[model samples]
Target: MNAECGICYEEYDWKERIPCIGICGHTICDRCRISMTSKKCPHCVRPDAFKDKNVNKQLWDLIRFTQLVFRKHSFQEEEFSEDTKRCSHCSEPSNKLRVCYDCCIQNGLVHKYMQEAEQKEENIETVLQNIRDQALCGDCVIDGVHFQHKTEYVDSFIESYSRFLNNRN
Candidate 1:
């Protein structure tokens, strides 16, 4: 599936450039959906088809997952690039990169959504499990990451959820 809107070719985002599902089951970006003179499916040209349509959660999840993977890969590429010096952590050519897990926990780097979910008595794990079960398919490639197993899907959901929470916070 394409990560961009068919009409404008803009990449989908969790924010303003969200993916919406038309009545005809075609994906449209939020911008294109709002810009239309009539509620029509931009891809199929079905009239009055996208009126009151909602964001497609599955597509949104996939896009977010792809974005997270892309970010991780980009960081890795920068770390291991030929021009950079080798770092002790990964033995990759990076500039003294070290992640302090204790510092992160002490600094409360964990976003507020997790606390909010706990306060609201909502089972975040269950929600993530459900998303993992329904949102991704078997051995699908999104963005540039090849998700060959269910664990990748689970990790994607976790990363996406963390990003969403971080953005909200």
Candidate 2:
């Protein structure tokens, strides 16, 4: 075997060689195997003969990790929306990346809707807890657009909750 890998620029050693077969029934290294991707062989780049399920698994794992970071920091965007926000991770401009529909679906976990839901829940809970704590006087409105008779406990609760939340954020 050659002493070096063409893709990784790593020196091919005896330890790096895996038991998998190339198209010519030659033994290749793990780095080469992954580089070949879904193809049957790194050198040949065919799809049918690369029988190891682990190869696909490894590829999926890589994509999954990338999808996570993309979703997290808005670096990766899926094909679901042409809008939303740009991803911060990739150097490529927003127009250049191939946004995948499947990846977009997976990326739904770290979306703006999720953030809005959390904020709504927090706001509702804050208001409810404020009512429970009697932070408002008899004349405080839950929504500023309207007025309601809130108890002393509710007033205190709202005050305390506001301080608690302000400190937390």
lDDT of 2 by residue, 1-169 (tens): 2233445656433344333444455445566675664656556655655555232333334444654556442223333355432322332224322222222224341122233335533564644432332222222233332233222232343455456545443
Q: Give the alpha carbon lDDT tens digit for every residue of 58-158 in model 1.
A: 98776546646553332234335565433222233333332222323344432324544454433556644434333322222222133332233335446
Q: How close is candidate 2 to the true structure, as a TM-score?
A: 0.22
> Could you estimate the TM-score for every candidate?
0.41, 0.22
Candidate 1 matches the true fold with a TM-score of 0.41
Please report how far candidate 2 places residue 157 from its true position, in Å.
82
RMSD of each candidate relative to the true structure = 18.4, 19.2
Which has the greatest TM-score? Answer: 1
